[model samples]
Target: MTRAKRRWLPALLIPLALVLAVLTGSVQAGATVSLPPKTADEVLAMIARTQVRAFSGTLQQTAELGLPDIPSSTPGVTPGAGTALEFLAGSHTARVFVGDPTKARLQIMDAMAERDLIVNGKDAWFYNSADNSATHLQAPKPGAPTETLPSKPAMPTPEALANRFLAAVDAGTEVTVGEASSVAGRSAYRLSLAPKDPGTLVASVSIDVDSETGFPLGVHVQAKNQADPAYSLAFTDLSLTAPDPGLFQFTPPAGSTVTTKVLPARLTPVPDADSSPKAPSPHGTRVSGEGWGSIVMLPAAAVPAGLTSNPQISQVLQSVSGGRALTSSLVSVLILDDGRVLAGLVPLERLQSAAAAQ
Candidate 1:
């Protein structure tokens, strides 16, 4: 949830969050709990206050996507998971963000018999192997508007839903029983949930609770996409502890193409525009990208409009180390180093102070 890029994938595939949910529930068989179904409102209440000090795990996302007649101007509409990351979490410690691209990190799919997309924070100078580009513009202020998953879906924020999911389970949302099944090689209980609202991106999810621990041993999100098929996620290798602190940091190698952060032609000189956040670019290009694994957003919107993209994004990145995003609605870009810009849509001053954590 704390990841700046945290978001839901399309219906064809399950959003990345399911991996987090399975890890939170059902620890070991020895640590099982009784279940009494709960409701949406009730579930929300419990998640709000749960203390999550640290987390780490392997995540799996598979989806069958539905594409529109026209290309989507939004995220999650894609038929495939846009990108996936392996993480090691901590409250105050750093977590390595692995970029396992089926295309970039996922590149292994081309070589290995059983494709393995694996990138480690400790061994990821590979980010610079690709052509990196960004636009230089004044950082925007905070209070920008981001359209929800569906253009009209009224889903709650991760912050809002985190506590709710737990609360709903504690309160017992109506749960129905299903036949036994083997998921990821374990006997588990299958629960079918009839959502009160079909409009939910997730109409039904099959939660595989470990028969031994009473906890979720494996979870699956089966999305319904007519436009694109093959969107669903099955997450294996779950853990509830923090990963190595080194996973979150990055250092671009020498001889990389550090392009300039350019501003869009549409947004250069607005006199009365409200605070706008530039869409931050990725550390890697679209053909391939590298995930920071763990993300901590510093509000740049609060800073003075003087904060523009690194005048020479290439020079800044080469001078420094690590990678980040510099984006806007018109041109969302990712910077590979801290000196690189992380795009937002707010005005520079407003976005600079978007958060106090920075």
Candidate 2:
């Protein structure tokens, strides 16, 4: 793996389709042991510890979300896999180092190449060795109550995935604790959640937390009516000590192409807002619904050429009425004839409903 590639892969790949897939059962570790079980109350308490903050370790990601057999064109482009098309439907490993909330490095290891995401405060860089390209972003200001990075549906790291599940534990969820287990040679507790909303396709989501630090060691998400996890991310090895500060810094190698993008400033509310009729915001891509059943809507004009021009993608689209609807065990996406795309963990009928409502 090149140093540049090590700085960008995790941020891009970890949140793609079925990025939540994880291995089931316990990893065989030496010496049998026992640990205390956690009650629902205790699990709730651990969920509140969202700022466990820093850790360094190796992450194993399994993505078998039942994605279609997407054909690859360029070295890193795979239509319909989102930005993580390069990592679609496979097993991969990456090294993660987080020194604090704003500084971290994730290096994904591949058999022939590597990629990395490196962030220090509001500066971030992504490099892919397979393509010899580096992307630089002037991240939106950090710590602003309203600031957010722009992306279709921002991908979250494994640590952030823990927080995502915790945030989903509302009145619509059923919570419980699983058996005590070991992860990365440390005692851990399993917390599980099942959505009560019939609109969602997720069967359940489970998190394994390190008993000592309250950090999530693994996450398993099962799709509705499926026997196996749709996606998961787990730590096979970990260390809680602070990582070296230098690990978060980055410099592109000579001969690598570099591109830069700056996020737009967030809009601020104006005074006397009620005095004037508000203008309808221009139509664009946005997500509807919430959590597991959430649907991403992309206006046809906004979709890239890869989605419309590819023959395989075209076949998938023309095979069914109302454009096209494709599904895997965990996810379903509907492309409407009007040039809009809807996707989520819900059934195709749900996506169709969302499109009709729009």
**Candidate 1 Cα errors over 4 Å, as ranges:** 1-53, 66-174, 177-191, 196-203, 208-219, 223-230, 259-358
Candidate 2, position 81, lDDT: 38
User: Candidate 2's residue-wise lDDT over 1-358, tens digit each?
Assistant: 0111011111112233222211121122223347776687776577566456677888776766666544333343311334444344566678888786677777777678777777677677777788888878675556645455433222234556766565555566777887777878888778888878888777888788777777777887777777767777777898888989998889998988888855434323221222322222234555565444556666775555455555654533434567777666666767777777777767788888878887
User: What lDDT score is found at residue 108 in candidate 1?
Assistant: 14
Model 1, span 159-277: residue lDDT tens: 22222222223111244555555544445555544333322333344455544444443333333332321222232443434545554334443653333322111211211112222
- State every prediction's TM-score relative to the real structure: 0.33, 0.75
**Candidate 2 segments exceeding 4 Å error:** 1-33, 68-81, 139-155, 264-318
TM-score of 2: 0.75
> How many pairs collide in each candidate, listed in order?
101, 16
| Residue 348 shift from truth in candidate 2, angstroms | 0.8
* Model 2 lDDT at residue 104: 71
